[model samples]
Target: MNLYTFGKALVKTALTPLYRFEVTGTEKFPDQGGILLCANHIHALDPPVVGMTSPRTVHFMAKEELFKVPVLGRILPQVNAFPVKRGMSDREALRSALKLLKNGEVVGLFPEGTRSTDGVLKKGLSGAGFFALRGNADVMPCAIIGPYKPFRKVKVVYGEPVLMEPYRERKASVEEVTAVIMASIQKLLDENSEK
Candidate 1:
């Protein structure tokens, strides 16, 4: 198995016993083809849980700083995580994500751009909307429910794919598209819980 698969297996092995990680709405996920897994970020663990539970390998956009860390930098690439500058428009990161989508790969994005310390769903960045509009990929709204604590049940809910046809082949602003994606995510958060 590749590093991502092997590592994901390890995560599941370790986490399943420590925390009851539950995944639902996976049947709603597309079996193949390019797709975006846009989720609300609450913890550092968000990315791995989302990636590991996903039906496909997810090429995630992580912060540029993490790549500078000694061992993590080496491992990030092997697991399909590219880095992005946090504050400014990181063209390099955008290009990497687009290329991956063009090749029919899954890309995970946290529209909020950073972890929400209080676990509240915050307004998402327009970058995620840009990806949905620019790439020929289905945008799937995802939510990570529950706090990341040992022995706690954390759930990853994959909601229905947000339809982007109206915005496709047209001139829709990124913010407008992002609102729709965020709304979808909100609905999932409304319906499910960690309990």
Candidate 2:
């Protein structure tokens, strides 16, 4: 495995016993090239959970303040995570994401823009749809179930990739497209969760 993939595996191994990590439908993930992974964020650990569980290297957009933490700041960039300014669409952040995509690197985006306090899927921003359209990349809708906590069985369910062409040509507004994407994510959550 590549260094990034190895590092992710190590993280997964370390975290698994702490929190019961059970991921299914990982086979649905694309085996190669770039992909835009859109997921519902419910906790601060969501990004790392997805990053470590995914079959390929997944990059995350973190808040700028996170980079100030001595340990996390050093480790994040090493593991393909970069900083973004929260509460604003930082153009530089978007550009950095786009650059990764253009180079066939996968990027993980939380459509809710931040973690959901109630652990329920919320209305998503249009950034995901916009990225898929602008990047000409497929969006892999993912659903993360359970609280990411010690001894909890947290599941990361990845769905088949959703192509952008149909959505882009549908004449629907960006908000409409985002709604559709969020709905798909909710469906995955409803079906995959331990009921």
Candidate 3:
């Protein structure tokens, strides 16, 4: 097996017994073509959980700092992660993401930019919207709920893909497109809150 598949298998096996993990709405994920997986950030563990549950290999736009770590720096790229300088537009990272999408790959990102320590969804950054419009890609809103503690139930829900055709054709502003994506993510969060 490849490194990603092997790593995902290891995580799934280890986390399943520690947390009651569940996944739903996976059929909504596209079988092919470029697509963006936008999700809300709740914890550090969020990305791995989302990646493992996804139907395709998810290339994450991780913070540049993670790539600074000796071992992680080497491993992350191999597993499809590229670093982005947080709080500022990193042109290189943006180009990388766009390139991946253009090549029909799945790129996952947390719109909030960083993990929400208090568990409240924060305002989304405009990068995701920019990528969707520029790359002519579909955006899939995903919500991850809990695993707050060991043995706690954790759920990952994938919502219907938000087609960028209409928004792109309308020349919607970045903020507008971002709002639509965030709203979709919020809806998923609300729907799965009790689960």
The candidates, ranked best first by TM-score, are: 3, 1, 2
Show where candidate 1 strays beyond 4 Å.
none
Candidate RMSDs in Å, in order, are: 1.3, 1.9, 1.1
Superposition-based RMSD of candidate 2 using all C-alpha atoms, in angstroms: 1.9
TM-score of each: 0.96, 0.91, 0.97
Off by over 4 Å in 2: 1-3, 170-172
Please name the candidate that would achieve the greatest lDDT relative to the true structure.
3
Scored against the true structure, residue 41 in model 1 reaches a CA lDDT of 91
Q: How much does candidate 1 score in TM-score? A: 0.96
Clashing residue pairs for model 2 = none
Residue 115 error, candidate 1, Å: 0.8
Q: How much is the lDDT of residue 118 in candidate 2?
A: 92
Count backbone clashes in candidate 2. Answer: 0
lDDT of 2 by residue, 125-151 (tens): 888767776676778899999877789
lDDT of each: 0.89, 0.83, 0.90
- Candidate 2 positional error at 79, Å: 0.9
Deviation (Å) of 181 in candidate 3:
0.4
